[model samples]
Target: MTITEYIQQRRMALAEQLLMTTQLEIKEVAIAVGYTSHSRFSSLF
Candidate 1:
C-alpha cells in the first residue's frame, strides 16, 4: 500500500481501539486521530 493508505489504515485502527478501550467522546477520538471534523470522522467510522 502507499504511505497515505497505510497512514489512514493505522489511524482507523487507532480510532477503533480508542473507541473500544476508552470513554472518550467521538470528537475527542477524531481529534486524537488527526481529524478536525467530527462529522467527517463519523462518516469515515
Candidate 2:
C-alpha cells in the first residue's frame, strides 16, 4: 500500500485500541490519534 494508506491504517488501528483499552471519550481518542475533528474520526472509526 501507499504510505498514506499505511498511515491511515495505523491511525485507525490505534484509534480502535484506544477505544477498546481506555475509557477516553470518542473526541479524546480522536485527538489522541491525531485527529482534530470528531466527526471525521467517527467516519473513519
Candidate 3:
C-alpha cells in the first residue's frame, strides 16, 4: 500500500488500541498516532 494508506491503517489500529486501553482524549490519541489535527485523524481512523 501507499504511504497514506499505510498511515491510515496504523491510525485505525492505534485508535482502537487507545480507545480500548486508555482514557486519553481523542486529540491526544491523534497526536500519538502522528497527526496534528483531530479532525484529520477522525477522517482517517
RMSD of each: 0.7, 0.6, 1.3
**Candidate 2 per-residue lDDT over residues 5-29, each given as its tens digit:** 8999999999999999999999999
What lDDT would candidate 2 get against the real structure?
0.94
Winner on lDDT between 1 and 2 is 1
Question: What TM-scores do the predictions have?
Answer: 0.90, 0.93, 0.78
Which stretches of candidate 2 lie above 4 Å from their native place? none
Tens-digit lDDT string for candidate 1 (1-45): 999989989999999999999999999999999999999999988
Candidate ranking (lDDT, best to worst): 1, 2, 3
Candidate 2: 10-residue stretch with minimal lDDT: 36-45
Q: How much lDDT does each candidate structure score?
A: 0.96, 0.94, 0.87
Candidate 1 residue-wise lDDT at 25: 98
lDDT of 3 by residue, 1-45 (tens): 999888789778978899789999998898888889999988866
- Full-model lDDT, candidate 3: 0.87
Query: What are the runs in model 1 whose C-alpha is more than 4 Å off?
Result: none
